[model samples]
Target: MDVCVCTPQEWDTIRSQRADALDASLESLGAQPVPPVFHTTAAPDPSPFGIQNDSDSERDPDDIPIFGEQLHAPSQSPTDTLRNITRSVRLNVNGVPRDRSTWKTLRDFVDERTIEDVLDTIESDRNALDDILARTSDYPESLSNTIAAIEGSVPAENTLPSMQDIFQAQGIASTDMASHLESLAAHFEQMSTALEHHEAGETFVHEDLHDWGTTWAEMNRDTEELPAILSEMEERLVSIDAAQWVPVLSQSRELSNVNRHSTKLVATKRTAQQNLDAHRRILDDLDELGEIMSEMLERQQAVEDEAREHVALLHHHIVTIEDLQHRFTSYQYAYSKLLLELARRRQYRDASDRIVNGMIAQLNAMTEGTFSSPQSQASTHEPEHGQYLPEDVCLFVQNAPTRWNVVPHNQELEVLPEIDSDLLDDARLRVGTGVAALGASQSL
Candidate 1:
């Protein structure tokens, strides 16, 4: 019959060694050796505005300007020009009045002097005139033309016009200038209010454009970094896929099954231990009964030598025999129960053996012939090959039968020495002639 060959200690040792080896191999497979650390000097910073400082040949081939001169050029539309003019006027007089002293200079010069007097004054002070003209040249052509007309109107007599004429001219010119300045101031105020409203309207638009540019820059940065981020994510996914998840899950399931089996085995062991204790108690009772029976037999023999106590002794012997019969019946019942328990234990053992054999087969399959079966170890100790028993089989000797005997036939029986005539007669009186003769023949 097949049986487990390895002792508990041997199995534990084997499993521990295999487990250690597996751990080492897994460590080798999972370990990522530290790469050599190389010290690198920092690279130069890129230009803040994204424009490369490199020469034309060294510049990135992919870099291209997004904005050209045309994108920043002023608009040609009359409406756009009007808007620009209004914005400029508003900016120039943001915190001051449109009719302030700075603007009164033109009206004052025209009011205080005639066309001729202003020319003589400018010619007499040419250096100051040069400075004023130099600063005033930026004004409109109309203003310049008015200045030239005043210079040409200068009298050849080099004398001022009459006070009466000057006053009349000043009154007319000042009234005209004041009227024009008032109109201009009113127009400036209207344009300034309109520009303020227009600028308010454009505020959100400008902010939106700024935000869009910022978003575009952020998107560009993210696009540049996308490849490395994707690569890292892909590597992590691959590592997850490459992990021994299936094997680990399978092992976990197997361990759970083992635990369940171990629980059942523990219950079985408890039952076996109880039965063993019961057997020990029965054996102790049997031993005590045997001693009692020996003493009773000695008392019966002692009484057989006393004729006066023969009747009482006979009565006592009969009672002792009945008690002995009852004890024997109890022993028989206990032995039957023990035998039944032994049968159940043998069945359990057989199931365990089957389980172990299946595991061994699985182990062999998994290892792909790298590991040998225990049966191979059992075959090395045939009587023809060696005197020593197989190690695995020897381990079983402590619990298994050492030797077996077959029942012999009449012809195979050996002759025995003759029994005494008196003893033969006494056995015949107790067992009857036919049984005595059968026993005698069997002995012979």
Candidate 2:
């Protein structure tokens, strides 16, 4: 026996002939139907050597469930992954039948599984975005409600925060009216330089200090009968006996209670002013948050304007937010003016308190006087012209006698029924001269 050997040229010719034969065989397999045997098992029964040379792989159709129906669990290892797929050589695409000519078995199988995984990722992202959007949808309604609450608390036209109303409400209580009226009158007489400067400055119209002239006129009218009352009181003062001093002590105690109430009113006003100053920026902060929400909503709109299912609802929230901003602007202006008015009022309130406090002291001094002789109680020394606080000076319209106001009288005239009328010698003096004092008078 002998071995056959070929030169380089002979080997090249043989290789070309084999290549052509393989290409022809590949075309023949691609044209024919894939036998069902290859589709039946992962490890099929062995066939003759000429069975397949280029086709990659095939599996039993029943081994793969529907692709999306049986999702791959993340815990499963790659080797255990199911090769479920939707596309098949038996199906048609675009009016043409699917077969070996248009579909590669192994490649198509892997591609379908990969596509399903990618779709799952997209679904997860969409669900996460939906959760965030649900929360986002609520913001505009809450913002609108907050703005409504603020607007409700605000006075109509910001009136209550103004000085006119603050002073008026605090000063006009039934128990406190007279004291405040008199105090305000005294304050006007001796206004502080700061008070004067505030009056001159233009923030809001001073409006004659909330129409002081009207108040002054009303005070004058109400006091018209006071002169007569004071006259009667003065007559009683001159005529009262020592026994009547108890009433004066009682009145002094009452005035002390009035003093306490007055101070409380002033303190309450101060607290209100402090509150206004503290929360001045609330509206500004709310407005900023609203702008931020609107910007966020605008970003969402850019992405979903055409495709969003709740486009109408989104547009409604945007409109509501815009309305809130417009309404908030009015409050901003009113709040600013209100604060200024209240600030000015505080100075006057202090001035008024000082004046009223001084008058209370003067009333205390007069009420404490008792019916005692000059020598029995040490005589009070006269105050010098400038010694008393300006408010302590009595500016009564009828200035009569200052002594009568400050000093207590020793007695009042009293009629004695038992005294004789004959001794007086008027017209006819009958048994009147003989009549003598009776009852419990002389014996005691």
Q: Best candidate per TM-score, number?
A: 2
| Reference-based TM-score of each model | 0.14, 0.22
Cα lDDT tens digits for candidate 2, 348-383:
655665776777666666644542333323233223
What is the lDDT of every predicted structure here?
Answer: 0.38, 0.38
Evaluate residue 118 in candidate 2 and report its C-alpha lDDT on the 0 to 100 scale: 38
Off by over 4 Å in 1: 1-308, 369-444
Put down candidate 1 lDDT per residue, 106-215, tens digits, no spaces: 11211113323433442344343234334434434644554465444443332323546534543554455445446546545644654676688855354653554434
